[model samples]
Target: MTAASPPSASRPRYAVYVVLVLMVAYMLSFMDRVLISLMIDPIRTELGLGDTQVGLLVGFGFVLLYSIMGIPFGAIADSGNRRNLMVGGVLGWSAATAVSGFAGGFISLLAARAMVGIGEATLSPAAYSTIADRFEKRKLGFAVSLYNMGVSLGGGVAMLFGGVLVAWAMATAVPLPWGELTGWRLAFVAVGLLGVPLAAVMLLTVREAPRRQGGIKPPPLSALWALAMRHKAAFAAVVIGYSILVIAAYGAMLWAPVHFARAHGMSPAHLGLAFGVIIGLFGTVGLAIGGLLSDRSAKRGHPDAPVRIVLASAVLQFPLMMGAYLASDTTVALVLAAAGMATVSTIGGLQAGTLQILTPASMRGRMTAIYLLVANMAGMGLGPLVTGFVSEHLFDGPTSLGKALALVTAVSLTIGVALLLLARKAIIAAVLDNDRAEAEAG
Candidate 1:
């Protein structure tokens, strides 16, 4: 059930092509996912929604269907055509986003967002599994980091694009082929259309990578359960620890622009340009740093490099992240926020690469499914929702958002650090033991 190393050799040129495709795919999904953040105010105004409703639309609604559907999709990725799955996901989510443009009320918008979740649910598991098949383990951290840059790229682009639209819409409705629409609605429709060509590119250009199972039978629920039981500490560290951390990370991310807008009296266009550059430049740099550090440390006899990097990043991030929320000066907050985001962004790809090291090839997709279920559901789902609830209901309404953000972030980061520490010794032991066993077998 252990992972088998392929014959060691230089990586092929096509591997680069594959990573590019997956990275763009990752970017496309994020653009669709985050375009709403810039338009939250307009969406609320048009839909007659409150903060809680916004929380449901952006946070829980997407993660609910995404987490539920990911399990079966994960299994299919293990045994089916992952490239096709990616194509279907792109098409489905793209169409759903277009539909979101036309939604008359909260219920309809929520439904459309749910389908977006379902489509996106197919991506990470399938993409990661395919990457594992194509790249050698040594280079994998870098490859994954490159792919994960989509978060920054996609998010940055969305903010920038939505900001332009927002400024324009404030002046006049965007002229569509049929008629006209508000900036927020038009944002949804515009992002949705982008996926059509991407889906076609995926189908025509990218070929499926072979599975790395070494003749292992198709993974079943029993196998997945057994895998979880076998690596409880590591899984707990990654799943629970990271999820807790994401409460801080993703919540801060979702609300950051609003903080700038409400507290600092900034425009959407300004927030977009600032954050887009920060995310595009700094976030990408951080991902590269994490990957290089991980690979180099592993080469220097630290098999637990990925987790180690994440743990260190967590400690360094808390102060910077909290400072972003608490700082009085807008410029100071943005500077601190950029630093915070770099550290926050470092963990995603490296952690996924680390888990691949831990899991058997046969179970990578399902294991990822489980990881995403807990991580996305608990992290992305509750982080923003709880932040909003505390801000709106528990604290002073709306004005207390920064304070609410700091409290949530501070608590979650602390717990996350503790969990990662718990995971460390277990991970080191597992890696050394596996290496020894593999050596003997060879």
Candidate 2:
């Protein structure tokens, strides 16, 4: 079934409030997801883990559960109350992160991380669906871009907070009821506790926008499958193209700090601060800029603005990333890395907003779920694991991390550009068809 426009004229002033809540929720999940990166050394020392094990803990373990659960949670979001799903998700991930602080060995820690992924899996599909319901299609690019800033914000804050949190935990030697909770353990416990209040805020302050389906019952799974089959070309392009971009993103995100430390001798705290500011400042700016450019371009008759922007970003990202990895001077490397990150960060918001624009309202949640299931599973599952494997096997030692990163990013970005270009004509056709259908319905 085709989508009809929501009565956007009656959208409440409180819609912005909903975006704020989701943004904070997005930030909370990311903090939990990335805090593990900062704790790698302590986790390795205490758990007697190797690079592969640590990669599994950070990459595949969490994402495997997240990808599997996204389909069900997405279906739930399509048919049920999204706000409640988000509340439950926030609480579940928060609790799991705190539980991770108490894990005794690799097995237990892996289990806890898996739970965290399950909880986080509930967020994006629901949040994106809600934003689509509340905002008009014309403004979706900017709105989704604003919402996606949480990703970079959460990641940056995690790195910065991890540095401070680690330093404080090490200095004070905080005693806990369970045991001597210091270093990485304290970081997990401290960050995990932050979500409790945020969850409460989400429950008390946010209201689910009425579903766009109105009195129409959500279509059956078979019908939904038919709809997906109808739009297979567009879906293939978006899901595969975006997932490929994420490979480069996750690879860089998971390993950039280690690269800087090994190659340039920057300390963790300094590296964290530098990257935190770069990702938080430049990444946010890039998302906003991309969204605005795409939105304005659409207004000027470019129906495929989102995909075009992604293609441009992919083009810019490869060269900058290669430069960052290959550069000898620390200052030059950082400048190039920051530019590369700004481009990389644009993909999340643009792809999400674009998908929302292309899919029907009834299927937005499930379609988003399918996209996440494929994108996260492929990107999060392989990006870090591949980089780590290269570092451990192909390279003589850890110091060759820059070379490994360069090779992975160069390949992924190139593939991503190809897929997006292939998807472009399909995306343009979908946008035009939706416009014609909406006009006819009106």
Candidate 1, after superposition: displacement of residue 166 in Å? 2.9
Of candidate 1, the 10-residue stretch with the lowest lDDT total is 1-10
Give the worst 10-residue stretch by lDDT in candidate 2: 1-10
Q: Tell me the lDDT of candidate 2.
A: 0.83
Predicted structure 1, TM vs. truth: 0.94
lDDT of each candidate versus the true structure: 0.82, 0.83
Model 1: clashing residue pairs? none
Candidate 2: residue 167 Cα off by (Å): 0.8
What's the CA error at residue 392 for candidate 1, in Å? 0.5
TM-score for every candidate vs. truth? 0.94, 0.96
Q: Residue 285, candidate 1: how far off, in angstroms?
A: 0.9
Error of 1 at 257 (Å): 0.9
Q: lDDT by residue for model 2 over 243-354, one digit each (tens)? A: 9889898876777877887889887688779888877787888888888988888888898888888888888889898999879899999999999889988877798888
Instruction: Flag regions of model 2 displaced more than 4 Å.
Output: 1-8, 437-442
